[model samples]
Target: MVREVITYPNPILRKKSKDVEVFDQKLHTLLDDMNDTMKQHGGVGLAAIQIGIDLNVLIINIPLDKEGSEDDGKQLDENLIEAINPVITHKDGELVFTEGCLSIPGFHAEVTRAENIIVEYFDRQGQKQTMEANDFLAIAWQHEMEHLSGHVFIENLSFLKRKKFEKEWKRYLKENSKK
Candidate 1:
């Protein structure tokens, strides 16, 4: 099932997600739904909170072609990463990447994140997994993990940039309301 993604200004997006203590059928279903939703929205990654669920879960599946690979631009299910209760165990260096969120549609901003990271998380089956990711993958982890902590990438912007974004966002909301 492709769940509706909760947008910005929704209180649920600000609510800190609770850790998944029970690895059961419900968790599995949520993960499945998230994958469907992410693909439907054409997002490289998604957090559980993005779908109005307050569980510490997120998935990342960058298209093979996006990494300059020879394969066609398709996101493979086998490459989908389900991170439950993820924690950034290590971070090194820094890089800036343009990021867009499903919640904040039509807005892309350059956000500085760790260039490399070691994340410790649990897979869909409750098995503990550790991933060492760099470049775009590392940025994805930092972005989605922030959602689990009730933070948004816009918060990382400079004061001036954030204020500008706020003005533009308010205008966008007004236009959207008319629709």
Candidate 2:
């Protein structure tokens, strides 16, 4: 079963995720939960902080699993790329695309992101790896990586544009309040 992703304006998103010093069953559990949560929410990626876990762990399986690229270049369990202490080391080109966060729910905003990026982080096994991603994959990386830094997709919007989504956001809040 998948877990519901926490939404924006939740204090968890603002708190920087802590480094995962232990690569054990707990970390594996988080990886599983993150993947389940992301899949359930129809999100390509998910961050630990988004799920209210302050750990430097994130799962991404976007353009990758969608295109069968998960079969190539260093296999990870079921295409779930768990990045601990992830950081964007380099970026190039730019692409603006609609983006939404599980935390924010019900709303997506047009946001500009690097079309290509070089990211550095540790794999779930505690091995350091740097990988390059482009197009949709890069966007997914940026989105999830931002969560590690205590930022949400809403922060990508302009003040006025963000205000425009208030009604829809409010509706989500109202509906969720009963849960």
Candidate 3:
């Protein structure tokens, strides 16, 4: 099921998500629904809070060809990754890139993130795992990690840029409301 993505300014998006304790069928279902929702919105990632679920869960699926491949030169059989209660243990270097969120439709901003990072989290199978990510994958991790902490990419923008975005977002909402 593709759940409705809660947009920006929604209270849920500002609230920190809770950690997933019992990795049961319900968690599986949520992950499945999130995956569907992200794909439906043509997003590279989706967080639980984006769908009004205050859980520390997020899915990231970047096509290897699009992101310039993962850390390894070899292509991954499965690029769709589910991170539950993720923690970034290490970060190195930095790069600025334009990022967009499914929740904040029609908005994109330049955000500086680590060029490489080591993340620890539980996979969909309930197994603890840790891996290093670089390049676009690292940026994706940083983006989703912020969502778990109740922070959005817009927060990284300058005050002027954010104000402009607010104006644009309001206009977009009003225009869409008429339809």
Candidate 4:
């Protein structure tokens, strides 16, 4: 089942997630739930913090958004997916993109990130794995990894940019409050 994502101003998002030591049933379930939640909400990625869990866990899948692909029965880009914990060992090639978060609704900011990276993580089955990603994959990994470190994408914004978003952020919070 998809879980409710905790929004910003929730203290859980501020605490760094604890590392996973035991690869067990609960870890497996959490990964499943995260994937379910992310797809349900049209999110590209999800972190344990978004689900109010404090663990070094996050999942990312960045499929290219091609028009009408979902409606035309076209096969999904398999390269666009896989679950990971994402420890960056090497990074190069920088780019900036405007990023938003599942945990911080209606807010986005430009964040500079490595365009390429080598990462180590576990697969869905808890098998230790490592991979190198460039371009979109690297950006997606960096974005999701920030959650495990108790950082939100908006934090990459300057104070002025954050201020610019404050009005819309408040409006989103207010609308969501009624739900």
Best candidate according to TM-score = 1
Which segments of candidate 1 are over 4 A away from where they belong? 65-73
- Clash pairs, candidate 4, are none
lDDT of 2: 0.81
List the lowest-lDDT window of 10 residues for candidate 1.
64-73
lDDT of each: 0.92, 0.81, 0.89, 0.78
Q: In candidate 3, what are the lDDT values of residues 120-148, reduced to their tens digit?
A: 99997889999899888899889988999
Candidate 2, RMSD to the unseen true structure: 3.7
Ranking by TM-score: 1, 3, 2, 4
Best by lDDT: 1
Summarize candidate 1's per-residue lDDT along 1-179 as a digit string, tens digits: 99999988888989999999999999999999999999999898999999999999999997775455735548977778999999999999999999999999989999999999999999988999999999998998999999999988999999999999989999999999999
Order of quality (lDDT) = 1, 3, 2, 4
Q: Quote the lDDT for 94 in model 2.
A: 92
Taking all chains together, the TM-score of candidate 1 against the true structure is 0.95
For every model shown, what is its TM-score relative to the native structure? 0.95, 0.86, 0.92, 0.85
Question: Candidate 2: which stretches are off by over 4 Å?
Answer: 63-78, 175-179
**lDDT (tens digit, per residue) of candidate 4 on 1-179:** 79999988788888888877777888888887888898788787788878998887887766544652333323244533444465889999999887878887666777899999988987666787888888766887888888889888877788888787777788888887799
Candidate 3 ranges with C-alpha deviation above 4 Å:
65-77
Total backbone collisions for each predicted model: 0, 2, 0, 0
Task: Predict model 3's lDDT versus the native.
Answer: 0.89
Local error of candidate 1 at 98, Å? 0.8
